[model samples]
Target: MKYFRVDLITATPNPQRCIYVGMHQDYSESFVGENRINWPDEKKAGEICVKRLLAGERGHYGPMEHVQIVFNIGWFPHSVMQQARTHRIGVSFDVQSMRYTGNRINQVAKGLLDIEEVFYLRPIGHYVDRKGRRYNYTQTQRNIDLQYCEQAAKRYYDLIEDGFAEEHARGILPFDYRQHFIVSFTLRGLLHFLDLRSKRDAQLEIRELCRLIWPHLENWAPEFAAWYQQKRLYKARLAP
Candidate 1:
């Protein structure tokens, strides 16, 4: 059970902007998709370039501002709050703050809480029944948490309706409740972020987002993308 949805709303340099800036090497604006490059084949490209980039054996790469990408990340409230601290790549989120607009909740915009990150620890009963059974509890607890959150949110809304202060009512909302955000960054910044967040040491939630974005960018900028992949992705076998 996944607790969130991550979408690449828009990326830059836009195909038009790339054309305007003469960044397009092989395709025209009309023919080019949003990023100007299509990449079902460039998965290997990232693997090659990201390794070299992270090794400090950089051949040629400039400042991080060459390319820009924006992500619409939908996740539990706790995740968004934690992710807000990831300022290395110019990250920003549209948080549902109770103090801001009072009880005027944006019902239309708030994404539903989907259980994604945390896995449930099942009881010993299942394990004893089946030796190889690896049943996940993500969906189970999510259902539980979601029901609790909904009731809490509803109660909070009721409190506000009855003249309670927004701040006080919002206390009921759990950190795992849904929240949305927009993260943007330049190519260089993204590279740095990837080096840090895409590693095994990074948080699983953020790492997932980085993994998804890497492939999307490969087709858009093969040269730059390749370089990044060589420098960062293959950090294991490559020399330091």
Candidate 2:
């Protein structure tokens, strides 16, 4: 099985500047002279921006919509992606097409010949029993699950080999199969995503994804990160 991972790819140039531009928009009519005004220190501006946001000032969130970020997320179960796609506002996704890329297998075990490799996500807490104790699946159980997925992969490949279209052949593939994608979101949208997905009640796989992405976001915008952390509005808690 492959573990989930998230990578920060790129972000808006001078993200603080973008925030300032958005903040300026709300007060643009008040400027007496030239419309453009320069803030000497971007960090100071960011701190002020975060303060206004935390104070619940009107239109503060509008500025956050200007800052944008992109991430390369991959190797997680298709089920996790299904949950992630629910947050559709101010965000965009470019996902791998199983219909087009079904023939490509990037994972191959060392010293294993003619093996149809199938990857899955082992969720952190989904296997817990009713007593609140973690239930470790025995080797036999693991093998049984793997066998089922392997059979599905075999059927999918066989259909393709028999001249069936990939779109049709992909029907046999399991939802546990791994997939990757590039996701983009505005700062406001990302905060909303983190708020919902990082919650204790969120899906385990996606919460893990949020845990991985949070520190990177903190690094990108420390002031805003601090405000979010302090507010605790999203129930953002890491998995044990």
Candidate 3:
């Protein structure tokens, strides 16, 4: 099986301080809640900012004090779930979860695979063949083990339904069960996260997600976005 690595970095601070560079056409000082708003027209300002960012203008935002961002990390059951949920109370995220209501944790049982294809049958062979020698093969033992784990989960869930303490019953669930969570970060926090998570050393899942998000931020908050990219480059050079 392929190990899954996921990372999520949130924006630092809150939106209260950061002046959103874009969204001027429809955005106003009132929209962002600024009493001493200064501009010819909120609509015109927003329009111009959005246009410029989309056109690739990057610089220092009005003030870095107001912007904040957060991220939701996704991966296998045990990997990022715990960390994500932990960040939920402290940070904010944009992912869905089953933790709110008492519900069954999602499950997608799979053994380690030589390739990325999904298979639903038992395979009988050594785990891996190397130099004409097979190793790590316990022959069907791995499958049997996972099956037993699934069964145990089902039994524990039933027990909980029958009045057993859920806290204890839940102990039986394995780490691979899929979970979801939310995390909130400010613009500053996001920059910090990206500085670490968006680099070549970052995990694949987080890095891919960063690639998807950076462009959007570049459009939404041009100055702040540009600052993040620059910060990332500087930090990378410092990595030994």
Tens digit per residue, CA lDDT, model 2, 127-238: 6655677676666776677777666766776777689998888776767677789999888878878877988667677888888889878888777788778765467632
- Per-residue lDDT tens digits for candidate 3, residues 1-240, read 233333445443323223443234234545444443554343444345434432343533333325555444444344444443332223455543333422443122222322112111223444433345546536477677666665655666576668877566666755444444455554444555555556675444445555655765665455545544554443542211
Q: What would you estimate as the lDDT of candidate 3? A: 0.45
Q: How accurate locally is residue 157 in candidate 1, as Cα lDDT from 0 to 100?
A: 64
lDDT of 1 by residue, 21-116 (tens): 332333344543555355323344333344433335653334235557777766534563576465555444565465764332323113342222
Q: In angstroms, how far off is 162's CA in candidate 3? A: 3.6
Candidate 3: RMSD to truth: 9.8
Overall lDDT per candidate, in order of appearance: 0.52, 0.70, 0.45
| Candidate 3: segments with Cα more than 4 A from true spot | 1-17, 20-63, 70-76, 81-90, 93-102, 106-149, 208-212, 230-240
lDDT of 1 at 1: 21
Candidate whose lDDT is highest? 2
Which candidate number would show the highest TM-score if scored against the true structure? 2
- Cα TM-score of candidate 3: 0.48
- How much is 74 displaced in model 3, in angstroms? 6.4
Badly placed stretches (over 4 Å) of model 2 are: 29-37, 56-59, 105-118, 123-136, 233-240
